[model samples]
Target: MRNLIFLFFIVLAISVTSCRKDFSTIPSFGQLEFSRDTVYLDTVFTNIGSATYNLKVYNRSNKDITIPTIGLERGNSSNYRLNVDGIPGKTFDNIDILARDSIFIFVETTVDVTSVPDPLYTDRILFDNGTNQQDVDLVTLVQDATFIFPGRDPISMEIDQLTLDGEPTAIQGRFLEDSELIFTNARPYVVYGYAAVPANKTLVIDAGARIHFHDNSGLIIDRDASLKVNGTLNEKVVFEGDRLEHVFSNVPGQWGTIWMREGSKENEIHHAEIKNAIIGVLVDATTSSTPTLTLKNTQVYNHSNFGILGRGTSILGENVVVGSAGEASFAGTVGGSYDFTHSTFANYWNNGIRALPAVLVNNFFTFTNDQGQEVIEPRDLTQANFINCIIDGNNNVEFIPDRVDGATFNFNVSNSMIKFNDINGSFTGVAELDFTDTNLYQNITLNGFADFRNTSANDFIIGQASDAIGLGDPTAAAQVPMDILGVIRTLNPDLGAYQHISF
Candidate 1:
């Protein structure tokens, strides 16, 4: 009887283990997926302004998912509304999605903004699909609704009660006893004509400050004075025009300019966005050598002439994007030197960058137009070293060296990528020591004199197992210390900005 009881217990244990294994093979309900990671707003608006965006819903499980309703709500407020057609924050219902299928839900909202009171603000929109919800934030700011009158010094305007739709708004301004001025507002304002910075005085601008310009209006810093514009990433300080639309309108010389006059030093500008101007940042000849002009994470876009014109010396940090409308993007004339790293030069009608014979440019990416047959012409560039840079252009657009009447231009490029659709007519003037990797598709058509003694076509490194692989000058600067990307510097660096170590 005891043996029979023990055998019965062993069979029961085995049965229990078998049942647990069968239940583990079963699948769960479903998973949710979204369309985008983040949304960005390019301009600021007020009062019944609306923008539309779409959210894609994906069903990842085998079972069907039912979206009963879709709506939006403010994260801070209990007020929730359905996102529907024609109405802001209107919701749609009865949307059935099959397994491995997706659908798009549109979201639109009208925000009430006022210019007489505070100018800039931000808010978040919470998107809920019955069971799950996601949040997206939006930013808005008031714009200057007025134009400037040209030909005026110290342009002045009266501060009466500025109202927004008959509402008492917050308007603040203060003039110090020593002729120093301070202006603060929640709404947008404009500056007309040429505004001059007084001598021996400092101008301090807070973050999220938006200053607009009337036609031909800009700021000029005279000798013995300084301007400090300190802004944050989220709350960046912008200097632009007073236009309703933020599109490029070819408004040449219509915005303000910042001129650092002679004898002026120690001017610092950080985290600023300067746009829609004629000349963005002008460092005059009188700028003292001790006070280096520093620009960090700054963007100068949609300008007419040079983006950042420096007649003196300057130091630009990483991640600088400069774009032009129809002319040269950057021109450094008169004894200018630039130490730029991880910067971009894009979208210009004329030359992308032109450094006078006295200037030096290092570690930059330059993009020129293919339609325009114009080449970047600098005068007397002494030592222009391109390290891990990218020069992109079309076949028609050629790379023309600076025209030195008597002196020679010394251009040394290492671990770089210079691409042109038409290599036949690309690059003019003879180079002293041209270390080019022959990975260019039209390398046979390239026209120029190069020091081929220390270079080899086998040294040109290609992206992959292409014919131009292993062709470049082994003695290039990028090969010595390696580049920002970790690839062993070879005797021949790759043809473009990036070097491929392994497949």
Candidate 2:
């Protein structure tokens, strides 16, 4: 009885193991995958016009699969035929199977929709391999017709003729409440030409906003209204042309000007990039007592005339760059109280900074003029103070003094560097000044003219040598603690932009 019971238990265990082996030996196939399951047509089309679309078919399986034919079907009905060769209604004959390969197919077809009817249509591409078939759907929607013109159009023709009073008139542009104005490229509009401040309105621009001008479009701020444009460092505002190719050319009077009209007050422009304009910023005598044009960390480049042409009443300019200009980068005519500091004026066709009377310049960098002989032409400048600055002039050119009649020009320089030419004969006009220790050169040139007065005062301290070391007011030697290049000023101040540091 014990033997029979053991034999029955052993046979039951063997039968269970045989069933597990049979289940494990069952065959399973991998999944079929595709790169894309849907296609989208972004444009809305009308009439019998045709559009071409590119489709990429990827083989994702490990084994190679053959695609014999692919055709488009609409609503379970073949509306149009797919072309494999040159003709329609043919199977793709030159098809091949490849493992992990992608093939691009171009499908060009005409729409059967008539007239200007807007509708959403669903179409699909069906691929057939004898009995096996797969379908990929495509969705497309048609929209209103858009006309593309060749070049920029006139500003007046582009915008709707709506006046400020909500009346029907041929007003060229519209102004939003958020101080934003959009100008289309239909017609060119001359701002500040017909009306200043957009017909009795204050112009305020948002930070990081862009004011695009069509070809030959400009704005002027009349004496009545004020212009306030303040931008942050990251999102600085821009005044640019609509088309990238159509920049403001170097032609005088080509575009309009910003005339701070008489009686206009409290105008502030900061952190802005004004590029490729005819004349960048023009400040005239019409400004009021409280009218202040404060330009800070702003860049003005590629202009026809001066970068900032100012006259009269307290303009504060700091950290500004005027580069690649046609004429003078800064042409300050007549009389204006200017407090300009920590600025760079470079690569101008004419003078870098042309100063008249009543200008106080401090802590600035002026590069050599590539076109003219002079860099900073101070014409009768009254009390021009240059502290901690760098002046570079190429071609052995001198800092020209403007020949203005009856103007007293006083230049006070401390801690600055001026180089005339590079070693390779490139014009890098940075002048060397050393004020810490007394060392004499064979010949010393002071302010473009040879000056042997106190030749011992030009020596720089060892290890504290710079281009702008001891060029400060010699009489006020005790007052200037350090040079412009951040070196400690000794008994005598350095002559150049940098002070010599021991170590």
The best candidate in terms of TM-score: 1
Candidate 1 lDDT: 0.47
Cα-based lDDT for every prediction: 0.47, 0.46
Taking every candidate in turn, the Cα RMSD to the unseen true structure, in Å, is 20.1, 21.8
State the lDDT of candidate 1 residue by residue for 195-232, as single tens digits: 55666777776777777776655776656777777766
Best prediction by lDDT: 1
Q: Give model 1's clash tally.
A: 33
